[model samples]
Target: MNRNDTPNGSPAAPQASFSLRQLSDADWARFGAGEIAYLRPVTVNGVHAIAIHGADGAPIGAAPNAELAVAAILQHEMAPVLLH
Candidate 1:
């Protein structure tokens, strides 16, 4: 998700950061990198799992792998901005 901007076009608060509950090993593999970007938490089989939502707002899978990937992307991308 893109970050919110102020009226003057300066970066404002980041878009809401959402995360999945927790996911199964198999479901984690079903998700791809793109889907992981917008992952959210959801319940499955009475267990907590990471939920990957697409542009169409559909549940692609429970992507546990996304936790690290997303964080790495954010750290790499946002660190510069945050530091400055």
Candidate 2:
């Protein structure tokens, strides 16, 4: 049987899902003002890295670990959130 199919041939329940929502005008404004940042775990050259992204979805910086990444973002007066 296919991975997505149950024993009886019915489709299996989804394991996980998410919805993307567009940012509001005020959100964009805050981003432009450097008030927000997002920290996402990433892999670089086969090594783990933390990628910092601006609210506008642009890459801001990266760090070798989450602690350093959060410190960097806070030092710049921006909020950091982990993306999983």
Lowest lDDT block of 10, candidate 2:
16-25
- Estimate the TM-score for candidate 2: 0.62
Q: Which regions of candidate 1 fall more than 4 Å away from where they truly are?
A: 1-37, 65-84
Which structure among the candidates has the greatest lDDT?
2
Tell me the lDDT of candidate 2.
0.84
TM-scores, all models, native as reference: 0.32, 0.62
Q: Candidate 1 at residue 42, lDDT?
A: 60
lDDT of each: 0.48, 0.84
- Tell me how far the alpha carbon of residue 26 in candidate 1 is from the true structure, in angstroms, after superposition: 32
